[model samples]
Target chain A: MALLDYFLRSKEKQVTTASKAKERLQIIVAHERNQRNKQPDYLPQLTEDLLAVLRKYIPVTENSLSVNVDKKDGDLNVLELNIELQEENSGK
Target chain B: MALLDYFLRSKEKQVTTASKAKERLQIIVAHERNQRNKQPDYLPQLTEDLLAVLRKYIPVTENSLSVNVDKKDGDLNVLELNIELQEENSGK
Candidate 1:
């Protein structure tokens, strides 16, 4: 029973860690999206502010954005931004 | 003539750099999206392989992924992945 309990606990820990990593990735992605939509001249300043806000809550790993522009009927362009998070691997 | 030539060369250099940066960013974003769609268990191995491929060509900055799941009519889940590239700043 003790061995079984130990195995169960380890599995639970792994699950928890994976979920936590996913959550962190979500936040970083959001930040990256915001940065990409920003004007090129303003990106650096905005990125710094975002990093500060994120650091206040949880420790973030890495944040970045990928932006795509979709053209409409006219000359207007719609931007789609993707944000991503990098999680540190902690092997058990 | 000398002053005009110098001005034109500087502007040309700036345009070249901006274009190059944008191209690099696009490649990174594509890679990130690919990674996010991959299964969790295979992510590490996939990431390493991708990095190796990217490194052989031009120098890449930083790459990451963010994934979102959207539910369709019934039980179909569509995954949206965002990939991003981090460019190092070199103010000239």
Candidate 2:
């Protein structure tokens, strides 16, 4: 019974340590995602900002444009910007 | 000159093929992200749906909760859900 109790306690400690490590990793990944999406040097944020400025004169809605940054090669990254214009609604 | 032209054309073709492959990979990754966030079997989506149903009875806004899934080990995945409550404003 004493041996079984020691084994169970060790297992609990291992599980706790694993959970802590996973939480740390999740925080790091979330930070990286935020930085990649919002940093000034990041291509996605730069393209979005540029589009926002251009839209002021172009008469385009914010939801009509979608911009994405994707990895091309192992290290190379590419940006793709797509804009869709809405059809004019006919009214009486 | 012909050999150089052939080499340049082949390089262009290789670049085109690589770009196509990258686009396919991007589509796959995006689909995986959507599936992982929305699929019924996925724990994150299940938890979110549960919370949404619960919030219908309670007072909660759409932006008050954040749910995420993370890989625990080589194969295991874990779900995390966090909810933040806003303080009431003091009106004059």
Candidate 3:
């Protein structure tokens, strides 16, 4: 969903931190059930390339978003991104 | 830090999922102390644009990375992305 709809829909509602964290995580993790292994150099490049493109659309500085891969077991690996977005008013 | 460094350093340690989640979050949240208000339409564009660029570097399809913005106490807001990465072996 777009940010404008989010603000317009929830402008009166108060979302809790714990709720926010999990809900956001569910959205991100929901799609990540697929698994793959990556070369060591790829993730950083991915993050950089992603930011370069995201910057064209949003105000993403160096620390605004982070992507990484972590192993679940010896065989299972996860790719995760933690992003900090601009406030709704500033996004314009 | 680069992915190579993460692998070389973490090659031995057994990082748990609970631990993994927090560690990843710490990396994502560590830098978000700065605050800003954003327009609502910015987030989906950011996620989409980021993925478009990331796909150029890695094998990211539709269900790979997820980004969202949530609120706390109405004023404190968060931008979060949960990304699933390729396996290290598959990356090469």
Candidate 4:
């Protein structure tokens, strides 16, 4: 009975450790994402490339456009390009 | 010289394996995200909850709103709520 009790306690301890590790990983990932948002080296070059492509279709200035790489769950990177279209630019 | 060459080859093999593992992980994650997008169980309930909260302030129907959980890189889940406000709802 004591051996069984010891095994059960050991299993419970392992589960706790696994969950704690997951929580710690989540915190670290979130912190890293925040830091990346603050200053990503590739953003400007990427934005410039995107803007050049977009200019062929739409008349957009640098001020009217914004771009960022958003980190998602499950190791997905989303490149979000936001363009504010002026009234004149629309309905064409 | 033979031993040093063997060590260098092993190191190169390890690097290749690590990069291959990363590529495989990326493909699996992309597939999982595609599958999740097709049928996510929580989206409707979350949308309903958001609509309920929004209705307290703005007069909106179910047709004018949308909600989805967008998975980002680095284990981030972004809940995007998009509401298409009519002309009457605007400039208030």
lDDT of 2 by residue, A1-92 (tens): 22223323433454445322211101000001211223233434434454554354234456555544544233234444433434344374
Query: Mind giving the per-residue lDDT tens digits that candidate 4 earns over A1-92?
Result: 22223323433454345322111000000101222223333433534553454454344656655544544442223344444433333358
> What is the C-alpha local distance difference test score of each model?
0.33, 0.33, 0.39, 0.33
Query: What are the TM-scores, per candidate, against the unseen true structure?
Result: 0.21, 0.26, 0.35, 0.24
Candidate 4 chain B weakest lDDT stretch, 10 residues? B23-32
Flag clash pairs in model 4: A71-B72, A71-B73, A72-B71, A72-B72, A72-B73, A73-B72, A73-B76, A76-B73
Runs in model 4 deviating more than 4 A are A1-44, A72-76, A89-92, B1-92
Q: What are the per-model DockQ values?
A: 0.02, 0.02, 0.12, 0.02
Cα lDDT over the full model 1? 0.33
Q: B70, model 2: CA deviation in Å? A: 47
List the lowest-lDDT window of 10 residues for candidate 3 chain B: B22-31
Candidate 2, CAPRI quality class derived from DockQ: incorrect
Error of 1 at A34 (Å): 18
**Candidate 3's residue-wise lDDT over A1-92, tens digit each?**
34323432342342332223211211121122222323343444544554565456445445555565564444434455555554334357
Estimate the TM-score for candidate 4. Answer: 0.24
Better of 3 and 4 by DockQ: 3
Q: Write the per-residue lDDT of candidate 1 for residues B10-81, one digit (tens) a residue.
A: 334543454333222111111122223343332334334434443433244434444343332221223333
Candidate 1 Cα outliers beyond 4 Å, as residue runs: A1-22, A25-40, A62-92, B1-92
Q: Write the residue-wise lDDT of candidate 2 on B1-92 in tens digits.
A: 22223323433454455322211101000001211223233434434444544353233456655555544332234343333433334384
